[model samples]
Structure formats: structure tokens, C-alpha cells
Target: MTASLPVAPDARQKPVIAVVGPTGTGKSDLAIALAQRLGGECINADSMQFYRGMDIGTAKLAEDEMGGVPHHLLDILDVTDEASVAVFQRQARELFDEVRARGNYPILVGGSGLYVRAALDHLEFPDTDPAVRARLEAELQERGRGVLHARLAELDPASAQRVNDDRRLVRALEVIEVTGRPFSSFMPVRQYVQPAIQIGLNGPRELLHERLHQRVVKMAEVGLLNEVAELETRGLRQGKTASRAIGYREFLKVLDSQRGVLQEEYSVADAITDTVVATRQFARRQITWFSADERVRWIDFTDPASLSHALRAVTDA
Candidate 1:
């Protein structure tokens, strides 16, 4: 792997293209087609998609959608285990190396900007402190995740801007508390990686919102509620990272209602509606994150012709 990384000076490095965008942007279909045509294999970068038995909500790729192209790092972790960005970077880098060894282009595909960027840049985060984590978790239990957000806002406003009002903020505070440095300050810069193009999918905000609504509806019809129920059987609580996932958290309300845990009469339909709204907000954040990356070649997904042109640019590059 080391020998292959620095073989030539002027010649373009074998591209490790990344297909990154917000959810419901058709990234999976485009990635499969791109892999088929470009001699590429996909490396999943979505954090939630890493969990086993988490298909419907994560929009996991079906067997038929793969189109005979090999995929890596999907459904590899049990819900009981935590998959961190540092862990993802290590495993995904190995897969990237293996793909390059097989003489195939590697495509990192997902909406998880942190995972994608960390893997591409070969980031190595500082070791975590269990003591800090314990304290943070205790604070979360006593107060709430909003307490961690307030702490992050005080400690590192830049990192807080990237984090939503959930586990992301909690993780940011954890990193800060453990490392004694702001999370944003310790970010690994791009180094010792392949030279390649990046592409981000885009659509009109209104159209994207509509797509998200339709997506949540289709997911409900396809048994998203049942999927969450199965996870509940495994003791997936709201405090875990897997439970904080958009679809999982929303359905949890309905699951509690059925379990006689919550007093309110929350229906599955209500959960589905909440999931749609949360997913739209998530998609907006994803777009904002990708826009920060100046190297990304953005394409309007609402127009098929624009996608064709974007693909041409990718091939031409």
C-alpha cells in the first residue's frame, strides 16, 4: 500500500472519488452506477448505516441495488457497539488501500461529512479519556444534551456551529473535555492521500423537503416501525449514538407508547411525520457542511441533465 501511494509525480493519482450529499439525493443509485462504469467499489461512510439490522431508516443499499459491484463497511457493527469516527477512519483506510491494491477506484459514499473528510484526510484523533466521558454522560443524564451544547458553545463555538442539538454536540464536548483542546482546533488537515475530485449533490430546498417527506412516507409503508421495534428488543436506549439517529429517535416515541412506557398516546403515524421534519433539517445541515468544502463540484440533483454533465466532469477529471 505504501509503495503504491507515491509511484509517480505528475501523473494523476488513481482517483478515490467521494459521492457526498444530503439524504434523499439519490447518492446510492449514482454511486452504484459510477462504480459499475469506473471500476470502483463503494466504502460506506454514513455513521448510522454501519449498524447491523438498521436498513429502512438509514436507506441502506439493497442486494439488487449493488449491481454486482463490491461494497465495504456496511452493517459491520452491532447496535450494542459504538462506531466512532476514529474507528471508521482506520477501517476505511484499510479498505481504501485494499481497493487500490485490486486496481479499482474507491468511492466513499454518504452524507456523514465528518467520516468522509476524516477518512479522506487520514485523520488520527487523540485518545479519549474515560473519566471525561463518564462525567459528560452523568451530566447528560442529570441535565440533558442541551447542557453539553451549552458547554460546547462556551468552550468551542466553531465546533458547536457544526454540531446539532443532539449526540453530535455531546461528542464534541467529550472530545474537548478529554483532549483539553477545542475539538475544532485538533482537526486533522488533508495529508498523505490520493488526489481526486469530489462531487456534492444539490436540489432546490423546496424540492428536497418534498423528497424527504415522500421518503419518510415510503419508509413507513416499508415497515420502518417494525425495524425500530426489533432494535428496541435489543435494548437500544435513547442515550446511545444509534438511538440518536433521525429515524430511530422518532420511532422510539411510538415504541414507548406501545410498550406502555410513555403516558402520551403517540402513534406510528405521528412518529413518521416527526421523522420527516427531522430528516429535512438534517439534510439542510448536510448541505451546509458540504458547501464548506470548496473542492466539491456541486450538481443540481433535480435536473437529470445536470447530473449527466457532472458525471462527465468526474470522468474527464
Candidate 2:
């Protein structure tokens, strides 16, 4: 049983609540508060936070921080496991329905824009061929991400512009090949599969940049290096997805330096800087993704009145 009083499935219809935006924008905090106010549970959408032993890097909140609200789909994978949006959509919807059936609000929270859409929208993913994917990945390594991105732009400019990661770029091209159409054709429409209220939390660009830098520094100061070190022993190096996560990847470079594997030593300072830059680029990508959807009610969540505004938005929706 949850700390909040449970409702019967037929008690009333409550829209699923989604709190989204860039990192360091307090979306998680807002989601928890909204869940408490609405007597709901949370479903995590941040892709990197799904691994069991990746607490520090992914910024997984402590149990005490959760404030007795039940959270689902966290720590459900190992460092070696790859996250599949198709599978996540299936599992997340199942858990979301269960929460609604129990008469509690199912709050969706994360910085991963696509994952959130996949959970709440009618988004479909195409199947992949290992042989085709392997060839694309090899070309990505040899020709660099820019070459693949340029090829994609020529074939599917809409999808090409939205991609910021090499893996995603490769995947988009693969999808175009497999489906014989532009990858953007498979994009989510501005409609929810379930009744839902989407709220985006953001702040001034300069402030968010500073906060992201501080967050990276804090992560480094608070054993982020050690955490990455531990995960390296757990096959993080071999995990295609987990190994490429922002903090984990940067710190792995530091690890190599510590072992004297590189001629020039990589410093903690270097890792922090790299992380900050990567995070800022990632935040820009996230904001762009959400901005494309007219349905999200954007709010400056750092302001004192945001709670009232959010309450009004959710209640009215």
C-alpha cells in the first residue's frame, strides 16, 4: 500500500501527470510534490537512471528523498542491459494502468523527452536487423557521426536535425532503410494514448547552464569517479548503452588516465568540464524536442507561484 489513500478504479478519471524538461530544472522535485498533492505514484523516464548500480551518475534520489511515494521502473536493469524504448513503452504502460486502476495518480517524470512521449503517445518503433545495425555502427565509427548525420540529412532532413547522439543518428538511418521512409514519419503526433497532463519545467538559459555546471562539479566531488570505477568492474565498459552515458563515459576517460593508459593524464577537472558541456548540449536537445509539441504547458518551476500554476493546469486539463 502507498502512503496516499488508494482510490477504486471507478472512483473517477484522473489524467496521467508528466513532469518534463531539461536536467537540473527540478522536474523530479516537482513530480514528487505533484504526486503527493494528487495522491499519486511516479514512473521514471530518465534512460540512464534505470540501472541498478548507477545511482551516483544518474542522480537517483535516495529513498528518504522519495517522501514515501512509490516509484516504478527504476533500478530494473543491470549496467550491461540495453534500454529499449519499445520494451519500456510496454512495461511503463502496464505499470501506469495498474496505478490508475488502484485509483492513484501515475506521475511520469524525466528529462528523456522521447521516452516520455513513447509512454504517453501513440508512438511506434520499427524492428531492427542486427546485420544492418552492425554495418551502420561500423560506418559510424569509421566515418564519424557527422558523415552519417549528413547522409541522414540528405535522406531525411527532418529526422537528421533532431538527432544529437551518434547512436540515435545511426538508428534513424537504419529505420529509414528498414521502413523505406523518412524516420520522422514514425514520430509521435500531438496526441496522448491516455488522458494526460504534460508540464514542462524550465528556467533562464544562463541560470540553467550554471546549475548544470555546478551539478557536474558536485557529482565529481561526491564520489562520481569512484562510482564509475566500481561500474567498470561490473562490465560497464562492455555495455553499449550504459557505457556511453554522460557521467560514466567522461569518468571512464579519467579511469584510463589513472591506470596510466594514456600518454597525457586526464584530470577530474577535465571530466567535469566535459560533462558540463555534454549536459548543456543535451539540455538544448531536450528543450527542442519538447518545444515541438504544443501540448506541454511550459512553466518556470523555480518560481514560488509555479505550484499554484501547475495545480491549476493539471486540475483544468
Cα lDDT tens digits, model 2, 1-317, are 22434546563378889999888899888888888888899999999989988988888999999989999989988999999999889888877767877778889999898799899999988878778899999998898888888899999999888998888888898988888988899887868897899999988999999998888888888999999999989999999899999989999999999999989989999999999999999999999998888889999956998878888998898
Encode model 1's per-residue lDDT on 92-153: one tens digit a residue: 87777677767777888999989988888756687677787777778888998777787788
Residue 183 accuracy (lDDT) in model 1: 84
Q: Which residue runs of candidate 1 sit more than 4 Å off their true CA positions? A: 1-12, 131-185, 190-192
Worst 10 residues of 1 by lDDT: 1-10
Q: Residue 163 in model 1: shift from native, Å?
A: 12
Cα miss at 92, model 2 (Å)? 1.0
Question: Which ranges of candidate 2 are over 4 A from the true structure?
Answer: 1-12, 129-185
The residue pairs found clashing in candidate 2 are none
Q: What is the C-alpha RMSD of each candidate to the true structure, in Å?
A: 5.1, 5.0
The deviation in Å at residue 71 for candidate 2 is: 0.5
Q: What is the lDDT of residue 203 in candidate 1?
A: 83
User: What shift in Å separates residue 232 of candidate 1 from its native position after superposition?
Assistant: 1.2
Clashes of each: 0, 0
